[model samples]
Target: MASHLYGNYFSTRSQRVLFTLEELEYPYEWHSKDFARGEHKALPYVSEHHPFGKVPAFQDDHVKLFESRAICRYLVARKPGHLTPPFAGTSSASLVQGARFEQAASVEQSYFEPPLEKLGFELIFKK
Candidate 1:
């Protein structure tokens, strides 16, 4: 059993996950959740795996995990050859990099959300 990646295709976090997986050269199954179809709202599909009904969930062997950054860090640590610090066991660089990326991504979203939603409402929804 390798792993499974569940996310909306082209999502920023999802892209990051895919990039990290590719960098690590890990073999995994990918399931693209459709946003337009409201696939993420399905309880049976999410409750079994995700408590928050979110995308970018991961499953490997008997363990299941969520959160894009966490998954990326796990991949980098476990598969050092992929996007990890050169001195894996002796260095904290990879961990630091993962943390930095997470912070930046979160910040970008928080900064963009208000303006984005307002634009969509005024331009698309005519509100």
Candidate 2:
């Protein structure tokens, strides 16, 4: 696999990763973790990939990464001018821009994600 994505189709976290890959036009092999079979919770996969046993783990030739947003950021960094504006230098403007980006990302993680994740869990996974 050129790159591999381990996730279920319906997971929002997985969707974020998929959207990033699509936006970047990057190709990856999708490995669906069968939720019905409890495959994501298995021993070696969980231990080696995600200790929390979450879906949406990613592996490319050089690295293994978990967390959807982190994976997206990594992908963007690989081709820095796409998806996000590059923080290319240490000029005052660049520093301020980088800080703003970090703050916005923090806001999404802290304020935006919890509620949406809860809603998705209740509506889709709670059954």
**lDDT of prediction 2:** 0.88
Candidate 2 error regions (>4 Å): 123-127
Q: Which candidate is the best by lDDT?
A: 2
Q: What is the C-alpha lDDT of each candidate?
A: 0.77, 0.88
Candidate 2 residue 29 C-alpha distance from true site, Å: 0.4
The estimated TM-scores of all candidates read 0.67, 0.89
Give per-candidate clash totals: 0, 0
Poorest stretch of ten by lDDT in candidate 1: 82-91
Model 1: number of backbone collisions = 0
**Local lDDT at 80 for model 1:** 69
